[model samples]
Target: MSAAHRPGLRVNAALIIPESELSWRFSRSSGPGGQGVNTADSRVELVWDVANSAILPTLQRERLFERLGGRLVDGVLTIAASEHRAQLRNRDAARERLATLVADALRPPAPPRRATKVSRGAKERRLTAKKQRTDVKRLRRPPTD
Candidate 1:
């Protein structure tokens, strides 16, 4: 089925953004369509208002704002696709891009790394290797009377 007919864009197992939340804007594409490039509106821009979406829970909404701050303008995220000559293909591309981007941003932050100290055995091995290297260099020097 075409992306236009889908009920919503599924960002993850828990988050599905309804079609009503997505808006599209199109314009003439800049490349590869030969004679049709100038007239065909193959470039697609998909915009979603992250701040106003009804589907998002409060925590998820705040996470989206925090993770996607650089990309969001007035709490809206926009995805653009122009690589395809067909409008429908461009639409699909834009949809996929939007889904991937939102999914990534919605992901939970990774747990903090725990600090670790070097093991005694590892420190001993390192010191042994250094001492071996020093002995080898001493052996290389010419013997004095």
Candidate 2:
């Protein structure tokens, strides 16, 4: 498939990818569906170079790297889709999936959570409960002389 078709359906307008940036390969699909599966090269694999992307900022690239981790090899982000029986459909699906992934990566995440200490009242309640449990267990034991 060509980049123009994929570009028109991109989720993020800010992400303008060059035609050469995307690489796609088609393979025969696997799974149920008998004859159709054997004849169709419906499996689509779309790979994008995240480290060298012209559209993404440095921060966005870092975030994507952190989120995708081991799944991203070198600098490339790979997406595969084969749910459809047609190569074109699978190709579109793969591109759509990549768009969503990139859009998600662009969004800023909530700041890291600050560590919090237990409130004094809560600590007191816990201690009180522990003392009550100790008293109950002591009562259960036979009375010591």
Candidate 3:
């Protein structure tokens, strides 16, 4: 994703993050990619401080914490991208991931399910099946007489 194509995310009614809230750091990536990966800083680390962000609302903050609490540390939201060979592409990918995370956090959770009781007909059917199995077992046994 290009800088021009970056989405405008509104955390609050007045505050909006238009590619500004994101901070990217490029570092030499480990693992495969031959010599290119060893020489170039292809790993992109994207950091967004959710706790100090003025854009997000209280509800959004709470939701973000609940959804991304594992990735978050010291009030900062961190995401890394190193799949691509190019640093810019990796950086863009990381930013996209962060945007996706935030979008998911903004959504409301489903309502809690209510406790349900089994129907009487269903219970009767279960008992009937058990009795039929018991009768079959009794028939298989020898008479006491």
Candidate 4:
């Protein structure tokens, strides 16, 4: 958290990442723009250093670090969006993706699974099946004493 508690690039009311923490790269989009594609950079790549970001609270930082570690490269998460023909749209897409990714990563972990025991009827059925298989095998063998 910054000393002045300023917020930027609002993902939601609860999660506001500062603009200074985000960086962007723009390039020519590869599809569907026709004449505009030659001159405009419609592809947007938004990069955020998630591991070292001060915007995240301690618990959220830990959750993001643990859950999204595999998706991050050198602790930086990059989201690229080029589906839209306009640069602004692509930029918004990237931002939305980043927000979604971060929000999902920061979600709380599921509760631990409780141990379960087999019911009496289930155990009896399993034993019955094993006995039937054993009896069939025994019956198939030679009857010589």
Candidate 5:
């Protein structure tokens, strides 16, 4: 982030990443820009180095890296936005995406589920239903001579 930009990005109330750590690049977007599409650099690519982040807590940083390992390339994560026609909107979109990805990756994994046996009452109900079906089928057959 340059002196031109005052406010930094706010990922959450607890976590804030300084704009200085963020890198932005703009390119001619392949998306809608009417006749100006070829000339306008509306596409925004936001890159952040998670490995060297200063704001992230140690535990959360490890969890984020572990969870986002496949997405990160050489400890850097890049998000590109071209959905909007304006460069500012695309930049915002990219930053929002980055925040969401970081927040999701930092979350703890859900606990594993343990295998459970069928309850005794449920087993008994199943057997009773089978017995009723057998009785009904037997009644449906003609009397044996």
Candidate 6:
């Protein structure tokens, strides 16, 4: 759906951040706009208040806090987009980026890894390879009696 008619930004099946919670800032982009670059505000910054959002579940909020700690400042998350020359495209890019980031943060953590030891056969093969390499190097040396 278009931004104008859309109710909120869909992060995942369980989460939809309302438009009211999103804020936008725009400035002239630094690259590739030719003459329009000077006059247009093509760079977009999309900010969301994750800590204060009404739509976030308790667990999701905690997960976001933990996963995005470096990115967030004072409980707010900001995403910037400037690759596009048009303001609308930059805005869309920012929104998509925010949604993806929030969805990843809300995902469950991976299961712990299980450690294992090398098999006896594998150890024997490795030893055999080392012996072969040593014999080859010894053969390359000149005979000394």
Lowest lDDT 10-mer window, candidate 4?
Answer: 1-10
lDDT of 6 by residue, 84-116 (tens): 998898889999999899888888999999999
Give each model's whole-structure lDDT. 0.92, 0.82, 0.81, 0.84, 0.86, 0.92
Return the lDDT, model 6, position 116: 92
Q: Residues 1-145, candidate 2, lDDT per residue (tens digit)?
A: 5756544435476666666788888889898769989987889999888888777777878888998877799988889998988888887788779878878777778899999999999999999999999999988999788
Where in model 6 is the C-alpha error above 4 Å? none
TM-score of each: 0.91, 0.71, 0.77, 0.70, 0.80, 0.90
How many pairs of residues collide in each model? Answer: 0, 0, 0, 0, 0, 0
Pairs that collide in candidate 1 are none
TM-score of candidate 1 on Cα atoms, chains taken together: 0.91
RMSD of 2: 3.6
The regions of model 4 sitting more than 4 angstroms off are: 1-7, 116-145
**Candidate 6, poorest ten consecutive residues by summed lDDT:** 1-10
lDDT of 5 by residue, 1-145 (tens): 5324746677777788888899998999895568888988998999999889888888987887899999889888899999999888888789889989888876678999999999999999999999999999999999999
Q: Which lDDT value does model 1 have at 72?
A: 96
- RMSD per candidate (Å) reads 1.6, 3.6, 3.5, 6.0, 3.4, 1.5
Model 4 C-alpha lDDT per residue in residues 1-145, reported as the tens digit of each score: 5313545666665888888898889999897878999899889999999878987878887787788888889888899999999887887788789888887776677899999999999999999999999999999999997
Q: Is candidate 4 or candidate 5 better by lDDT?
A: 5
Once superposed on the true structure, which residue ranges of model 3 sit more than 4 Å away at CA? 4-16, 135-145
Q: Identify the superior model by TM-score, candidate 1 or candidate 2.
A: 1
**Per-residue C-alpha lDDT of model 3 across residues 52-132, encoded as one tens digit per residue:** 887777988898888888988988988899998988889768866876777777778989999999999999999999999
How big is the positional error of residue 11 in model 4, measured in Å on the Cα after superposition?
A: 3.8
Candidate order, TM-score descending: 1, 6, 5, 3, 2, 4
